[model samples]
Target: MLVNQIDTRQGTNSTPEFSHGNTLPYTGIPFGMNYFIPQTTFDNTSWSFSPMSHQFAGIKITHQPSPWIGDFSDFIVSAITGDIDLKADVTNQMGSYRPDAATFNPHYLSIYDQRYETKTQVAPTTYGALLKYTFDEINPKIIIHIPKNGSFILNENKNEIKLLIKNYDSHFNDDFKSYASLKFSNKFISTLITHQDNPKYDSMILSFNNIDELLIRLATSFISYDQAHFALKRLTNLNFESAKKTAQETWQYYLDLISVSDYNTIKMSTFYHCLYRTFLFPQRCFELDSNNNPIHYDLYNDKVKKGYLYMNNGFWDTSKTVYPLFAILIPKEYHQMLLGFYNSYLESGYLPKWLAPDERGMMPGTLIDAVIADAAIKGILTKSEIRNFLKAMLKSANQESHDTRLGRMGMKDFNNYGYLPSDKYSESVNQTLDYAYSDFCISQVAKLLYEDKIAQKYSHSALNYQNLFDPKTGLMRPKDSSGNFKSDFNAIRWGTDYTEGSSWQNSFSVYHDINGLKKLYQNPNFIQTLLKLSNQKPAFKVGGYGFQIHEMTEMVAIDFGQIAISNQPSFHLPYLFEYTDHPEYTELLIKQLVNQFDDTMNGFPGDEDNGSMSAWFIFSCLGFYPVCPGSDEYVFGIPIFNKATIHLPNGKQFNIKTNRNCPQNQFVQKRMLNDQPLKSRSLKYVQIINGGNLDTELCLLPYSKENIELPFSLSN
Candidate 1:
């Protein structure tokens, strides 16, 4: 099964200094409310579960999206065979575990502790999980650690324990709490709840005298303890094996959406693992109530609201590729997500940019505009819903929020100066470019709703990116309030005006008007500029960030020249070659870039950033990518697989076939859609969803031709 084929630790071999995908070995159902990971250390940091670690801390119930964002409502469960002193220091209680023998699948997790001589297995449900422990010695005990302010109640008669904890990073109410209920199969011979002035040391220990085996059914809720109990009912009649099988089936249903036929087992494994990463984000923050209606804890109002809500996603990253994939393969789920985003807008008064349970307001522009616009163009949202979302988009574009993290950073200045001034805001170049693209997306939605005046306004604002374009450098330079480019402009400098990249990586971010950007350059001719970007040495300077950040280190480590595929800003760099006459360059670059990924511990070049990189691989493997989401077109690349099929939600199959697809055949010689010659280096959204065969012929030699039809550009 594809689920079993995935090593959840594919990207766990990473440190803060560098990232090999910087991902946790998360074991849970797709978009489950809670994810379980075998914690290896006592440090409550983001690097909790490293594949290289030998110490077995416990199984952590985490709601953490990224280590950068931190975790919320998190705790640990561990089993010990002998009596151990109850203390706050988890490092002392940690036991040795063989990382090679541990199982880290998406549906299940199993680890053996040498000190305890116990085997612990976990099978996940949507909101809860079934944990089984086999003890080789007597006096088997279960430990539940609450790292912060929390309290627990034990019911000896019911063989259950209820826990409530108040632990979060930010954006939650003061009274915010996470509740959990644990039902044990064996009655406790003795119970001890440790309390200390330092809340980090508090824990609950339950000992069973003679049981050789024990089972723990755990359920968690953001609402109440009763709700947690209600969620636990899902595993009431099911055993560990049954729960594991059900979790596997749940993941298989999603994994079966795309099937690849390739003889290369290694590449096939890599592809499916990338596919697995795609469905692990924007998790359901809502819970099913008594009547099976969805309700969520609204942090904005500090009350439970009746609607669908999702969290742990940054739209600035996912909007590029993740939602586009969803639009093509799973429009139903995409539609529901759109509704959830709209609900967030209704509650928070602006569309979310980064939502980890609530508005993080990270990144530069309100790029969720692209997600909404893509859905609007694809007809995934209703007319009224589109209208409502358009209002939310425009509000963020015009009005500044009281909390800077809730909406666009420099809204008033952007409106006044046509671009964010470098002196006024950090990463102003990225902020300006992102705003322009967002404006273009706003225009798309406005046009769909027949709001011609609003469409014209945003469409005009979309060209504001031209204001910061430096004709001499052929790069997007940062400008001040007086409309002068920054004097000390260095193309290789990272993160002064750009968002995690330098001018070489962030300059060509003109997704809406690539043709226009090209026209701005005459001597280098934009195509030559892209060549310079790819051919130049991977050099960088500590620009705005006085120190070399991890992103800079990763970019240099990958050695992909100035094209830092490790970050999102450079995601569409290779595809930009398609806008030029030399389309074969894109094919060559994509083939080279994809080789960096595999189905191992070091699966990605850098932080996957909530499936953005994974979706990029998925799209490139299928021989196309969504360069401009709101533009309704996918720029062509070279397919990596011999054959693949996408099962669309509309019961149609979009098949992609590549002739002579191997390491030798790196360039596209010819392309056909539904047996007709595809002259343009792009595919329309309708053509994909309607579903037909997309065939391509690959050869080692580069194919060169003039007057090649380019992708969608505003100037065209």
Candidate 2:
């Protein structure tokens, strides 16, 4: 939502400001900024803030405190006592591997403390992680003089080392900028490394206020263990100068991978976070130690027998949205990401789940199938090696495609039966829908390379879900093995037939291709039958698409209480209306959903899968969404942010001019290609790919236009 028609950021020429995510801060967003941390949540792990001088501004993550290593000591002890090999059991130890019930009580927390005081319960974000956990800038160096000269042993984790400094005499008066300089009676590193580490899932930019804050953070985070500075012992054999050079080079190299031309803040933060999230997985294994070569994996990995590179907590779920969006926004890296998946498959015999350094043990489903196949077709992964993996993808899809325990038990005999077999883990209408969608993706990859027979085979498998769509109720629902509608379940219940929380959700789950789905209803009688579902009420014991469910949105259940739209499984549900006569209704629905679920503060409806969940918001606000990953297209939806400039990776900038209207004027009126009249609810893939800008004219029209063909993006 824009206020007074002002952009949240007015390009890069303005002063850099930041917002405390946990509290209301007048400061704008910080970019290329380094935030100082006075505390961290990785429990009991010792750390301190000491940033290099030239790293500019930064901030810290301050909101809810998180469960730290200190919080997990008992768990660690158990893992170790149980002889849990650090490498092999790293995922479990990381707290990411647990029964769904186990994770309900814990949270992922990263934040600085007591920096900015505010009225909100969320935080007083004063500083960042003390050790200045970054070194990506040129001449990135920090001089830490132990107050009273303390003896400290620095501990290195998956990426960087940390420590605390205090009680130094040569101090600056309360002059703000002077606080950034270090006063040392004892020699620290003599030289320091210039980069820091962040998980692959966040933005590398730290948000901060001033040099003094960064220094004050270094000055007060922790007490000295013994006075004698650990630096006197460690720099005995370090090539700090070359390391600094390498760090600068790494920054430039990463920058080279994508373009940043939009509202610099949005593009940089968004792009950096996308890149940062990658760090969360395929763990960073090799670092330049004076001479560059792979060191044994980091302490966390070494302890867990995991490698240096970790892909982190998110996987195929985001690959559907984030990874595929990157295919167009940042194609080269996405290509590399595909290869990384391929290689992980080769080393591990299956596509790594979250890839927490390529661990295929977490999460359900072989989701990589959709991403890989999509990437191969879009030319993002044009290598023959990828072609080989496509074959592996097929095998993986066939062997591990879990079609809800019930869908496979002779349930395909629809019309004759009204319900699924009354077994514990089946109905599987939802699972079957996704499986069919995945099959469609597989078929697309086969088709792109002219593998006609392979494509034909998958095409049939992909359509298998059509058998589940019930004509009487128009719901993608369950049927008995004899094809009769299930008597025990209501069409509005979300849990009985699909993933997460319903048919309202599953009915719209077909993301691979939309036209095929529309064809399913082309027979007028079939379309009318499905209309009854729109008015169905929630049949669940209790639930609403709210922040509690996470993917904040308006969730309506069909089949009693089986589908909840506020969860990831149902995140893409609302747009299903775009495939009907009520396209504008779908457009209005998205705006209402955004208002209900997101704001500038907590921008998502639920636990954002890495950035997969947030990616939906980002792109939708830009007037579209990447519903089907790897398709090189975005389905038309609604734009929340009044105007957004998408900096293309191709060094061009495109702006989503949201001129149509607000929640009231939610329909697309007349679209234009530059100045010429256009007739689609969506734009062209070639236009976005080749750096074309989109400008839309909107009106609060009661009816949607039928003249233009909606690109495949908004199909289903």
Q: Candidate 1, which segments miss by more than 4 Å at Cα?
A: 156-158, 195-199
Candidate 1 residue pairs in clash (backbone atoms < 3 Å): none
Q: How would you encode candidate 1's per-residue C-alpha lDDT over 448-528 as one tens digit per residue?
A: 999999999989999999999987778899999999999977899888788888899898888899988888897767887
List, residue by residue over 1-716, the lDDT tens digit for candidate 2.
11111111111111112111111111111111111222212222222111111111122221111111011000000001122222231113221111111100001112221112110011111112122222112222222222222223333321222333222221111111101211222222322222212210111111222122121112111112221122222322323333223333443344344333334244334433333322222222222222332222222222212112223334546765666566656676566556555555554445555543324243334566777766776677666756687677665554442422101223242212322342433536754665666666777777777889987877777676677766555567665555565676554444545555556555766676566766666444433533444445544432222222311122431122222433566556556666556677667766655543333233323344444654555555566776666465666886654555655777776666657455568777656666677666565566676665567766777554665565573234
Backbone-clash count (model 1) = 0
Model 2 misplacement above 4 A: 1-310, 357-364, 399-427, 479-485, 521-539, 542-565, 597-602, 660-663, 713-716
Query: How accurate locally, in lDDT, is each candidate?
Result: 0.89, 0.41
Please give the lDDT score at residue 496 for candidate 1. 72
